[model samples]
Target: MVSDGANNTMAFPRETVLKVASLARLQLTPEEVDLFATQLGATLDYVARLDELDVSNVEPMVHAIELTNVLRDDVLVPSLPRHDAVANAPKTDGKYFLVPAILES
Candidate 1:
């Protein structure tokens, strides 16, 4: 395990990477395993840097910035006539739109 002296976080091993890939149902080449091991290790090291910060006084917040809904007010509207709604469709049975079957038995 490769470790930076400043933090206790250890670099992810090839075995760990392979295990995670298996759990995630990924089929990775040998080169990809090594690449992912390095990348994942770097990501952990970067995140470990956060432990050095002084967040004791910082208050927890749901979002970094204030968020407000930008949606318009909801109001009841008249529905379009069935014929007009299906007029431009490639295939329709007057009451419902026809679509190709997407599932096989």
Candidate 2:
């Protein structure tokens, strides 16, 4: 059973699980459907318990912890010469690697 957030609990029906599976394009067996119905019901009950918590004094933020950029400064670096870069390629035209055409007109 799942809570209604008003001290009321209700069963999470199998029909709801089937409908969710259909909407998600999932093909679930009868056993799986029953399992999901129970699991989802428990999850909803947990969320309802969380809803009872008092968070009025808590500040709303995008994340639980402050985030700062951790990326290193970009620096230009020397790269492998073009000929050496394509030397190990299966097919090359000396200037560029040749790949099979994936599309045709």
Candidate 3:
């Protein structure tokens, strides 16, 4: 465990940790800030350790298991009319659905 004192042993500086938290819009306590700094530093150290591995011959893959794309051929199909689609809706602006505003200036 990393100490929350001046004589701490974290890979990242306290100020850096606080800056990251601020950018993320997180409100962290002093203790939480120290803890997160220690944890994040340890994570970075682990990633650094991984950088030393020899993977030059390995092929890049998106998943650990083999996978194949399963998709249907694109085809035009009959669909519901716009009026019928919004018939049961509580609110609609004729061509589009009406939703509550989310942001305030």
Candidate 4:
């Protein structure tokens, strides 16, 4: 267990820490596990404290600043021909670019 500045405490068990580390594909040393257990406990405690705030009158907002769609009007534009587009390609099979196979059978 660890305490946040607001007096709230949260338990960060070793099993839970190990599970999180495994899910994230991380390799943590025993020393790192102990360090993260305390850190994650305090973080969870701080987040738990947010539940005590009054938000009944608050409106849901997607972002802190006001936002509006700023997209440009859709319009047809000139484009390079397929041959021109492939001109700079390192390897091309006339109509498409080719690359080395990336996977093993």
Candidate 5:
């Protein structure tokens, strides 16, 4: 939104939005950009209003499913053998199966 001159509106066209997204390495279509601009504005407005509320002692919740850790007997049971477990793994070196790195290089 930093403008090169004064008195400029931050508003942008749908095509410009698509081009900006392309520069951002995104491939959103013109229609998608229009939809996103509307949704994004609404989302930002909602978040702005959330700051007006004072939630000082509100306990953060994990899920509203109303279910806690599933209970089970504390007793342990035999599991798959170590060799059998690693039989089909693509790579196993340190007594564990190694998986591909999730992060891009």
Candidate 6:
């Protein structure tokens, strides 16, 4: 496991990046491979700097604001009627509405 505090002293290898791409089923060209190698390498370097922090007294916050499930009463509220729903539709058959075919058999 990576701790919140780690030194930015280690190098992330290209082999690890290739292995991870394989796991993700990504087909990377040589150019993309080299590009991602640099980007992922820089990202790992930034992640390593977090290791120097002493978070012993700091609370681990999941979000900047309080997160609590607020339940609401299940009650029927005013809603749009069927006529209003189809009011602006381009075309409709008296008892039903028609739409463009989504698929061909």
Candidate with top TM-score is: 4
Q: Quantify all predictions' global Cα lDDT against the true fold.
A: 0.81, 0.78, 0.78, 0.80, 0.68, 0.71
Q: lDDT tens digits, residues 1-105, model 6?
A: 543223322254567767888999988887776666666666776686888998899988898887799788999998978787777777876445788887997
Give the Å error, residue 69, model 4: 4.9
**lDDT score for candidate 3 against the true structure:** 0.78
Q: Estimate candidate 4's alpha-carbon lDDT, on a 0 to 1 scale.
A: 0.80
Per model, state how many residue pairs clash. 0, 0, 0, 0, 0, 2
Give model 1 RMSD, 1 decimal: 8.4
* Per-residue accuracy of model 3 over 1-102 as CA lDDT, tens digit each: 433334344778789988888899988999998877777776766567668889999988988887798788799988999988988889997777888897
Model 3 poorest ten-residue lDDT run: 1-10
Task: Show pairs that collide, candidate 1.
Answer: none
Instruction: Give the Å shift of residue 63 in candidate 6.
Output: 1.1
lDDT of 5 by residue, 47-86 (tens): 5666887888898787888687899999999999998898
- How far residue 55's Cα lies from its native spot in candidate 6, in Å, is 1.3
- What is the total number of backbone clashes in candidate 3? 0
Which of the two candidates, 2 or 5, achieves a greater TM-score against the reference?
Answer: 2
Q: 5 or 6, which is superior by TM-score?
A: 6
- Candidate 2, backbone clash total: 0
Q: How far in Å is the alpha carbon of 91 misplaced in model 2?
A: 25
Candidate 6 steric clashes: 2
User: What is the per-residue lDDT of model 1 for residues 43-90, given as tens digits with 9 covering 90 to 100?
Assistant: 787777779999999977888786778687699888998899999889
Report the poorest 10 consecutive residues by lDDT, candidate 6. 2-11
Q: Work out the TM-score per prediction.
A: 0.43, 0.42, 0.46, 0.47, 0.36, 0.46
lDDT of 6 at 71: 84
- Which predicted model would earn the best lDDT? 1
